[model samples]
Target: MGQMRRRGTVAAGIAALVVPLTAALGGATPAQAATSCTAGVGPYQKQAEKFLGRPVDGKQSSTDCTSIRAFQSKHGITPAAGYAGSVTWGVMNLMNQQKAAGKTPNKAGTCPVNKGRIACVDLTRQLSWIQDGKKLVYGPVPVRTGRDKYETRTGLKKIYWRHKDHVSSLYDVPMPYSQFFDGGQAFHSVGVSMWNPPGSHGCVNMTKTDASKYWSLLKTGDDVFVYGRKPGT
Candidate 1:
């Protein structure tokens, strides 16, 4: 009976070792694997296509993955790892559904005033756009404007200065693609995650890619309209 008990104990020890080894060899579990954007036909693929401004075909293509990565990067989606997984799908779904429901801007009054080219910042929506007459040239891209005490000034102003690489003397921070409109306040690229917000001092913060695009389109003397109070004042 004592000999039998010892054999059983040895068997149990081997079983425990086997389980962990099998798990390690098998790699990520189903739940962890599901986080990657697999290439194939699926509803998530269709949603990702739509979010990327591609046709919603329910089929995954290389273009779709690239665009998804771009969107993920812009929105500060992590693993920013170019996978349209659960988190990516969730963010895209929420934003796309909201846009479909007309929560996004179609037009702003200031867009038509310039007639040539203008950048309009809608504080209420935390969105910014570039327009020429009635034609939208660029965004409805997300932005982080100044918070309460340092509220970004309202009213129309013209781009008076631009620096492809600028450093803030006052704050001692790098402000790449800085386009100054209202005094010290400028539209510049920020490296910090803009997803969960604290807010900027008095500048308009954009992703580096968006800021570069802005620099390419806007020149000195371009009109910039800062209007609408941020939601909840």
Candidate 2:
């Protein structure tokens, strides 16, 4: 077990990767843009799956489409036909909308940290700390933020679940000791090269030392806080 710590002050700061979705559409043929046969050969399925946490199998076979469509509608983007062709490509170009939704999957103060010696995230300082009933246990280590078009998540919340060494195809990074609080987001590790302000894939990235230290101290139901945005914009 690790040493316990007290809750500290938190501020907002940010980081992450930028794969442009429009580029995917500009290269596709016109025919591929309108045909929506569901499933197979399209970016929609892939994007939707990443958004929904399940396989779409070229068909709207689950609540996946509903979730995807809801996200798209909420952001005022046309939902892809669950395919990877032209339509999917076109919709993807408006990924800023998707990225924004990814940031606020849960409302502020919706997932408050239960007062029982949990973890906390300070987005402004790009730090994560583990506490033990007002005492410090883990850290205040340096972390990275979202890059590309992705925006790292923020707001008041606490971790409810954790996964050890979780890998994701969508985020394309291995989240060591993944702490899932809001939908599809977690505490994880990214390449050291991404050490600047915005060098993550939406989730906050931390150094091995900080992550390992906190990993040992943190349990499932800990308090986690998030705030801040990219350094400048």
Candidate 3:
């Protein structure tokens, strides 16, 4: 078994690609299939339909529920009942925004340009990337940051430590490519999907590939600029 582990489950993150839902769903869609799903119009029915490419009629239908519920289940959202509530819509909304974020996510100039070889973490977009004096060095990949009470602190920090096979001292979970920059908070790879609900315990969770890339691209004393407030936080 791989050492990588999330606090809850791995089915939603990288492992999801290994298990295709095609055969089980009769080739419907990994994110839009099921025999049973919630019924009735949800609070964000129209918005969900727009995001999922479903017919944009405000009323909820069986097909819409199936699609929405599948998306919920895919992202590890609670209920997975296709309610199209604020929580579900919120996730979809962020995804839509991310898609709109084209080549330059830092075009807003929020991250410091003077910092050489710095990692930029935008909690509002739930994305992270590296830059070398205005030039994009690495990815603008999705990430999972600390939620609610355990919010990831916003400010500039430096990677103080690293451990390839680090295990969480408090949660007892494997945190691969762990790079600590703040107290109990690091950029590590977890099994949970970046879009998974609630969030991490004040750590910046990445995919194994992303974390590995980050590990190779970043080093001790590398500046990490974190800004913006995560929605619902």
Q: Which candidate gets the maximum TM-score versus the true structure? A: 3
Going through the candidates in the order shown, the clash numbers are: 0, 38, 0
Please rank every candidate by lDDT, starting with the best.
3, 1, 2
For model 3, residues 119-202, the per-residue Cα lDDT tens digits are: 999999888888999998776777899888989999999999999899987988999999999878999998877889899989
Highest lDDT, which number?
Answer: 3
RMSD in order of candidates: 19.3, 15.0, 5.8
Relative to the true structure, candidate 3 reaches a TM of 0.86
Candidates 1 and 3, the one with greater lDDT: 3
Model 1, 84-154: lDDT tens digits are: 57666765544442243232244436444544799988776666778777766676666778877988999
TM-score for each model: 0.58, 0.47, 0.86
Stretches of model 3 off by over 4 angstroms after superposition: 1-35
Shift of residue 213 alpha carbon in model 2, Å? 2.0
